[model samples]
Target: MPVGAQLLEGGRIRFRLWAPLAERVEVSLEEPGGTVHLPMEAREAGWYELSTDRARVGDLYRYRIDGVGEFPDPASRYNPLGVHGPSQLLDPGQFVWNDRNWRGRPWEEAVLYELHVGAFTPQGTFAAVRGRLDYLRELGVTAIQLLPVAAFAGAHNWGYDGVLPFAPAASYGHPDELKDLIQTAHHKGLMVLLDLACHYFGPEGNYLHLYAPAFFATDATGLAGRSIDAANPVVREFIIHNALYWLAEFHFDGLRLNAALLQEQAGQPDLLEALAHAVREGPGRERHCHLLLGHDRRAARYIHWHDHSVPRRYEAVWNDTAQQAVQEVLIGAGVAAVDRPLERLGACLSRGITAGGPDSLLPSAFVTFLQDHACIGNRALGERLHQLVSPRPLGAMVATTLLAPMPPALFMGEEFAATQPFLYFCDFNPDLIKKIAINRRKSFAHLPGFRTPKARARIPDPTHPATFARCQLDWNSVNHSPHADWLDFYRRLLAVRHRQITTRLAGMHEEAVQFTLPGEHGLSIRWTLGDDSVLTLLGNYGDLPLAGLQRPEGVVLWAEPGEAEHALNQGQLPPWSVVWLLRAAG
Candidate 1:
C-alpha cells in the first residue's frame, strides 16, 4: 500500500472508530487503477486504526469490517455520487479561504436569514444562489442559515433527510461551487452557517445500517442512522472530524447543529465538545470558526464558558419558544394580557434553554426567530403570514422584529410577502413520502379545518417543478400593496436595529441594556450609554390609542413616516406596530 504524500510530512493521522460488533476492520481504497486494502490495528474501547502507505487526495475509500460489506468512510469527503456511493478522498489544505479577518459577529449582532437551497431559487444550485447575496445584504442580514444541503436520496429533498454528511448535494452544485459560495458570502460580509443533520438519515439512499449494525440504533426515536454516538470513540471521532473538515477546508463560519437533543450518551467526551475545542484552537492547525447548536427544546440552559463572558463557547442556540410567542400574537390568540406567559419566549431569546426556574425554563441564551423553514414546512407551505397579519401586514412585521432581543432570523421571501407556500417535498421516496403524509395528517388532525385527508398527502414527485415552485420567493410580489408595505417596514426595522442597537452595544454592557414597557398597552424604553448617546424605542401592540409617553431631552433620530407610524410613537399601537428612535450620536 502506498501512503503517497500523506505520511511524507511526518504528521501522524490517528484513526479511531467505534465498531463494537465488528470482529475485525480494514480500510479499503479505490483508485482509478484498482482497489486496495490496508489492515487496521485495534485500539482500546472499540476503535480501529491504520496508517496507509498510499492514500491521498481524490482516492475513493470505505471500511470493510471482518470482510462483511463495504462501508463509506465515517469521516467521508464526497458523497459525490450521492449517499450510496463511495467516499472520495479530499485534502483539507486545498481550498484557499478568504475569511482571514472574519472573527464572526457576536450572537447579539446576528441577523440570520434561513434558506432552503432547492427552494431558495429556481436553479437550486449553490452557484445560482450567489446572485441573491446582495439582496440579503441590503436587508441587513449578517448571516445566512442554510437548510441541509447534504446528499440525500433521489433528485431533491429538504436536506434534513440527508444521509451523507460529508458531500454537498450534487444537485446543488459540486464542492468547489459550495466553496465559492462561501467565499462570495465572506467577501460580501455575510457569515454562512450550514444546517447539519446528525440525528436521523432521510429515507432516500441511506446505507449506514447496511454497512454496519448499531450504526443507527434500532430503538424508536434513536439516532436514526445519523449518529456517531458519544459512547463510541470511533463514531465520535468521525463526527468531530467531519465538522473540523468543513471549518478547515471550506472556510465555513459555523454549523447549525440540527436536532442536538438526540445524540445522548454519558461521559464519553462526545463529538460536540471535541469539535468546539478544535475550532477554537485551530489557528495553528488551520483557522478559527464558530459553532451554534440548534436544539428542539424551547427550554433554556446555562452554558459554562472558559471565562465568564456574555458570548461563550457555543455561540447561540435556536429559540423556538419565540416562534410560539409570535405565533400566538400573530393569530390574535389572547395577546392582550401583559402578564401572560412570556417566559418561554423571553427565556428563549435571553438564554439557550426554555426553562428558567421552578415553573420556568433554562438560562442558556439563544438566537430568536418569528418564522422559519420548519414553521412554513409544517403549514404545508400555506400563507401563514397572511393568516397572521392579513390586512395588518406592517403590524406583524413590527411585532416580530422589535420584540426579539436575541438576533432575529427571517425565512427567505418573508420580507417581500412571497405568498408561495414552503411545502414539504422529498425526492421519489415512496415509502418515506407516504409516512410523511400520514404523519402530517395525524399531527394536525385536531386542527379545525384540516379535515381533508387528500390535502395531507405528500406530493409524490419531488423533482416536479411544482414542488420547488411552492417554495420559490416571488420577487414580483414586492410591487403589490400589502407585500410592498411589509417589505418597507422590514427595511425600516433593520435600519432602526442597525442605527440604534448596533451602535449602543459596540461595547458590551449588561447594565446598560434594559427592557421597559409602561402598562400592557405600549412600550417606551430608554437605553443610556453613559455618555455616548441614548436610544428610545417605543411600540404599541394593541388596537386602541395611547398617549403621555414621556420622552427625555434628545432629538428624534428616526421614525416611521405617516399617520399609522406616528400613532405608534404615542404608545397607541395600531394592532402590532412599532417606532424606533435614536438619540443623536455625540
Candidate 2:
C-alpha cells in the first residue's frame, strides 16, 4: 500500500515510487494513442506520486527516473511480459473465488507435499497443477506447499531467484489462473501454501540497486551478496506487504518462509519478528494461516522460544536437523553414541533439534521431511533419497518420519519414486549463466565425484536446457510395476497416519514420550497419547535381524514386511523393518 500502482475508486490509478537517489521521476503509461509521460509530484522523504484518470486497468506502465531509462514497477502485481519488460495493471477483485468459507485445515492434519509449479507437470502451469488435485487428495495429501512462483528472469527456475516479490510468474499463466488453482485446491479440502524468499533479490532483472542502493545492506551473505536492508522502514514494509499480498490477494492458506540471505541471522531478529507480527495482526486473524520458518540450521527460537500472546510465533520450523541426522544414520556418519541412528534421532525426539536444543518444544513443533528441493537439488547429481539409499533403510525412514509426532512433508516426486533429478537449474542472463554453471560445479568441489575439473565438468551444466528438462516428472511411469508399488506404500502410510496418528497428536509433547535404542541399529520409541493411550514404534535399520527385543504391548497398527505378529512372537525385528502399535486407553 505504501508504494507501487494502486487503483482508486472512480477508475483513476494512483502511482507511487520511492527513489531517493533520483531528483525526479515520471510515469510512462502506454496508451492506444501513444505513450503518455506524467510528471509526478515530489513528496516528502524520497517519494514520488501521481493520480490520473488517463490510466486504467490492463494498461502497460513503467517508471522512468530523470529521463534516464524506464523500468518495470518494483511492486508490480503482474508482469505478463516478463521481469525485464513493462508491468501490467491487474485488479485483484476481478477473479471470483468460490471457496469463501474455506477456513483451512489444522496443522496437525497436514500431509504436506512440496512442489515446484514449473516442474510439477510437463505443462508447468497453475491450471496443470489444479488438474492434479483429485490425484493428490486420493493420495491422502491435505496441503500442497508450492515452491516460490514469484517472477524470476527466465521461463525456468526453482524460484529462489525471484526478483519481483509480488508478481506471479508470466510463465505460469495469468494471476487469475494461480488464484483458480488455489481456489480449486481449497474446494477440494486441500490447503495451498507458498514458499517465499525474504532477505534478498536474485542476481538479474533487479533495477532497485541502480536507483535505491539503500535498499540493500552492506552484507555479504545474500544470494548474490546483496542482503536486504531490513532496518529501513520501507524495505521492512515491502517484505511485510509481500507476505500479506500473497495471503490476502492470492488466498494461500499459509507460507513457508525461507530467510536464506545469510548463514547467521540469529542475532538480528527485528525484521523477522516484525514481519511475523504484521501477519499475525493481518490476514492471520481471519483463518488458520500457519507460518513455518526455514533457517540455515534447525532453528527454533522463532517457533518455540517466543510468547504466544497473539499467535505471533511460527507454528514450526523445517526440521532439517532430524532429516540430516536420519541421513547420517543411513550413511553411518555420526560417531560416539549408544546406537547408530537412534543416538541422533533420540536427541531430536527427546530434546528439540533447535540451534540450542530447547527441551520445552514439542516434536510437533517441527516439520520433518526426508527430501526437499534444497537437499535434492544441492547434491552433485541432484539425487533423491531413494536413489542414494537402499529401499529397506529408506522405508524405515519413511515410517519414522510420517508416524512420528511431528508433521511430515514430501517432495513432489518422492511419493511415487519418480526418478527424475530435481536439479539446480536457472535461466540467468547470458553473461551470468556461465558463471552460475561454473559455481554450481565448484560448490560441489568437496564431493568425491567433483574432486577434479573433468569430473566437475560432468556435474551437469545447470545452464543447459537438457539439465532442466532432465528434472521433469515422468507421469507415464507411475502406473508401472515398481513405481506403482511405491505409490501404494506412500498412500497406505499416509492413510494410516491420518486415521490413527494425527488425531492423537494434539496434546503430545517431549515429556510424554520415551525411547530405547536396544542394539546397534535398533530404535524403540513410544508416545503417551492422551486418555492414557500409548503409541509405540519398533524399528530395525540394519542388514541382520535384531533379536531378544521385548514385544510391545498393543494392537498392531502398521508393519513393514507385513509380519508384526511373526516378528513379535519371535521376540525380534526383521532387518530394515518398522512396526507401529497402539495401546488404547482404559
Candidate 3:
C-alpha cells in the first residue's frame, strides 16, 4: 500500500505510516465541526493504517504517536501553515493539469535557467512566476530548474533546509499553484526540473527522529544532522516514492539530486541509481524523465560511469571544474589557485573537465555554468560575476560558456547581469541564526578584504527578512542600456547554439570534438559533424590582441562586442574575446 494520506474512490481517504518505535498511532483529523481521533490498526513491519470516509481533500490532519502531541505527517502532501503546522490532505485528482501532451526535452537540447521562487520575483509565489514564463521562453532556455520547493520550518530559505520532502512550501502558495506553474511552463515549450536534497533533512521541525529513528544512519556524518539511512528499505521506498510523486503527481520533468556524493559516502545502496531506475522503468517512464547528479569536484566524473553490474544511470553531473576554470579566467588567475590555467580553461572549452581524462563523457553529459546560486550566494557576500569583472571580460565569459560543446545553465538574471546580491538567506530560529552568522563570518576570516571588522559587519544575517527582500531580482534592468546589451548577447548566443551547433553535434561520439591551444591565451575548438561540415570556435584570453592567427575559410557566426569583420579579416583575435566560425565541406 502507498504511504501518507491517499484519497481513494467514493470520497474515502487512507492513511499509512512506518513508525517502528510507536506501539500505537492515531490519525487526528481537524474537521470544521470538531477534532476527530481515530485509532489506526497496526500492520506488519511496524506500519500503521487508517481509513475514514469523514476525511476528504482539504482536511487538516496530523499523526499522534501513543497519545503524544500531534506532529505533521512524514509523507505529507501539503503543509498549509508550514512544516511545524498540521498537514493538509491534497487529492492529486482534484487539480486540473493541462500538460498532458508534454513529453519533455532531451538533456543535450536543454538550456537550463535556474531560479529560486522567493528571490526570482517580488511576489515570490508560484503564481507570480507564471507571469515570467514568456520571458524565459524568449531567453531561449528549454528548461527552468527551480530551487527546492519542499516544505521547511520557516517562511524563507534557500530550499535546502526543507524537512518535508513530499510537501511543497506553503509560503510559495498552494500545491496546485506549483502544478499551475509547471503546466504553464510546458505550454510554453519549457521543461521544469526540480532540485532535491536527499543527503539530509533540515534540523527545524524534523519529526523523523521522533518516530522512526532507524530512518537515520547512526554512523552518518554531516552538518545537516544525521544522514538518511539509505540501507533501510522503508527509507529507500520513502525516497523513491517521493521522486516519483513529484514526477507523476506534480508533473516535474526531471530532478537535480543536490549533493549526491553524500549518498555515495554513506556506504548504502545507491539511491541516485534507484531514482534513475524508478524514473526510467517505473510509472514515470511515459514522461521523458531526466536525472542530474549534483556532486562536488571529486565525484563529478561518475556521470559517465557505466558499469554493467549497476543498472542506474544519470544524464549529467554539475561540472564544478569547468565552472571554476571559467570563473578563474574571467575574474583573473589569482582568483583561484589553478595550475596550468590556460590548459585548464582550454580543456573546459574543448572537453568538460581537465582531470576527467580521455574516458570522460561528452560535453553534453556535463552541465556547465559560470554563476550558479551556490557560486554567487554561498559566499560571505553574495557577489555576481559582473561585480567581480568588467563588462567586456564578462561578455567574453558569457560567450565562452554558451559556445562551449556542453549544455549551459544560467542563473536567474544572469543574462541581464542583475546587480542584486544573491546572499545566503534563511529563516531559522534565533539560536541557529546566531550559529549560522558566526560560522559565515569565520569562513571569510582568511580573505584579505573580509578580514577587517567593517567587512565582517557587512555580512547579512541569514534570518533577516531584509536580506531575502534584497535578493529579489530587479526585472526593470532588462530594458536598461548595458543590461540590455548583456541580454541581447545571451539571446544571440543561444540562437546560434540551437540553429547552428546543437543538431549537428547531437549524436556524435565524444572524440569527434577536438580542442587545442594555439597560444598561451588562445584556444581553438573544432567539432566535426557527420555531414562533413565543421564548426570552430576561437577564443583569446589575453589583454593584448592575438596576432598571426590562422583564420578558417568559413562564415563568421559571431565575434566579440567591438571586433567582428575587421578582426576576422585582419587575422587578429581581440583580447578577451570569442569568435565562432563554420566551414562547409564541398
Candidate 4:
C-alpha cells in the first residue's frame, strides 16, 4: 500500500494513481487562490501515492502523470461537465441538514416519484430543483427517486453510462450543491432515493478497463459485465466500499440498485446478504444513515411466494409485472386467463404478483404504466394514460387507488398530465454516437410500419431551451378545465391512500397484503389491520357506470361525485376513473 492509502479513511487529502505506463506522477490541487503541487512516492504494482497536510475537504485537485497536464480525479467528488471535463472540490459536511426527525417511513407508506435530473426542471442543476420539493411533499410522496448522477462520457447523458462511480455529474452542480438539495428535501419531509446502475458500460473518458482488468467480470459473450460479482472478493469489496462512500459522503437516504435481475445472480450465495452485512457491520458504516433499495423485477416470486432469503429481503422490486397486469386489463387484452378472471384485477390490489398466478399466464408485477420516460418520443405510444386506457378516468381510478401490496411510482409529468415527452438522448464520444444512431435505426426498422429514423431521433438537444421546456412540470395545466379536473382526481387518489389505506397497512408484513382484479374492467382489494380491522377497495375499470356496489366500511376515503353518495355509481365514475372506500371508526 502507498502512503496515501494510510489516510483513505480520514478527511485529510491523499492521492493515489495506477499509471503503470507513466514514468512519474504528481498530485496537484487548484485552490480559489492558486495551484499547489505535492510529490508522489512510487509503490509496488505501478501505483503512486502521496499524503499532504495542506489538503482539506474542499480542495479541487487532479493528478498529472510524467509531464502531462492535470486530469480530473478518476474518483472525483464533482464533475460539472459530466466526465469529459475537470473536477471540482466539494465539502460534504458544509451543508446543514434538517431531516433529524425523519426515521424513514416503512415501504408500505412509500409513494415514489422518479425523475431524471437533467430533464426534471427548466434548469437541471441541483440548486434549480430546490423549488419543487414542496410540490412533492404536498402530493403525499414519501420518496423522491433520482436517476443516476455518476460522471459519464460527456456534457449530457442519462448517467447510466457513468464511469466515475464517486463523482456527481458537474451538470447537476457540485457535490455540496447536491447536499443542499438533499437537505432541502429532507426539511420538507421527502426521502431521497438515488438510482445507481452497476452494469457498467461506457465508451468514452473512462480508463478503468485500462487501469484494472480485475474490476469487470467476463460474460459468455466475453463482454465486460457492469456490476461487481460477489464471487470475486476484491470486486465485491470495491462495490461495498463505493456504496459506503456515497452513504457517508452524500447523505443519501437510500440507493435504488438498477436492474436487480442482473445483480441478484443465482448460485451467488446471496450477494445482497454479504452487501447488507458489509454495510451494517463495516467500520463507521453505522455513523451514517442510509438504506439499500433493490430495484428488482422479480418482486412477486421472491417477496411474497417464497420465504425470507437473501434476495427476498430487498426493500422492493420495480414491480413491472404488476404494472403490466394492470395495463393488460385496462387495454382489454383478451388473453384467456386474464379475461376470465374478472376479479383478478381486484385480487391484484390485494395479492399483488399472485394475481397473475404462480406461473403467471402473463407477466406479474407488470410494473404497469400508461406512459414512462422509456416510451416517450418513440412515436410508439405517446404520453397519455387515457390514450392507453381509453374512456378516461375508469382505468385511471383502478390503477391509482385500488392496486394493493405493490407500491406505485409515477414519472414527473404524470400527475397533472404534462404533454411533453422524455426522450432518450445523450452526449457520447463521436464513435459511440455513430453506434447509437445505427443501433437506434436498426431498432426502429424492426417495428412494424416504421421506415424513417426521425421519430427515433426526437430527443431534444439538452442545452436548448426547448429541452428544458419539454421537461418542466406544467403547473398551469392544473387549472385548465379537464386537465385541472384530472389533477384534482390524482389529489383525491392520494388522499385516499393516506387517510384510508397506507395508514392501516404501514406495519403489515408482505403476506398480509392481498388483491383481486376481476375481469378486464374492475378490481376489488381487501386489507386488514391486525386481526380486527378490515376494508375492501373496489373500482370499476370500464366506461359507463358501475353501480349497486356496497361500501365495505363505515367510512369512504374517496369516491365519485363525493363521499356523500357512499355507493359507487358508474355514471359518477366517468371513463377511466378510480375511487376508494375506507371503514370508519365506530
Best by TM-score: 2
* C-alpha local distance difference test of each model: 0.61, 0.82, 0.81, 0.57
Q: Candidate 2, after superposition: displacement of residue 145 in Å?
A: 0.6
Candidate 1 TM-score, true structure as reference:
0.82
What are the per-residue Cα lDDT tens digits for candidate 2 across 182-257? 9999999999999987576888888877788888886343237466887677887888888889998999999988
Off by over 4 Å in 2: 219-225, 260-269, 296-298, 305-312, 333-341
What C-alpha RMSD separates each model from the true structure? 4.8, 2.7, 2.8, 5.4
lDDT of 3 by residue, 351-403 (tens): 66556344445667778898899889866779888988988878877887786
Q: Rate residue 266 of model 2 by lDDT.
A: 62
Clashing pairs in 3: none
Model 2: ten consecutive residues of lowest lDDT: 333-342
Compute the lDDT of residue 532 as modeled in candidate 1: 55
lDDT of 4 by residue, 276-355 (tens): 55655642244333343443434333334132212223455564444445555555542222544445444444544443
Of 1 and 2, the candidate ranking higher by TM-score: 2
Best lDDT goes to which candidate?
Answer: 2
Error of 1 at 499 (Å): 3.1
**How many steric clashes between backbone atoms does each model show?**
30, 0, 0, 59
Q: Using Cα atoms with residue i matched to residue i, what is each candidate's TM-score against the true structure?
A: 0.82, 0.95, 0.94, 0.80
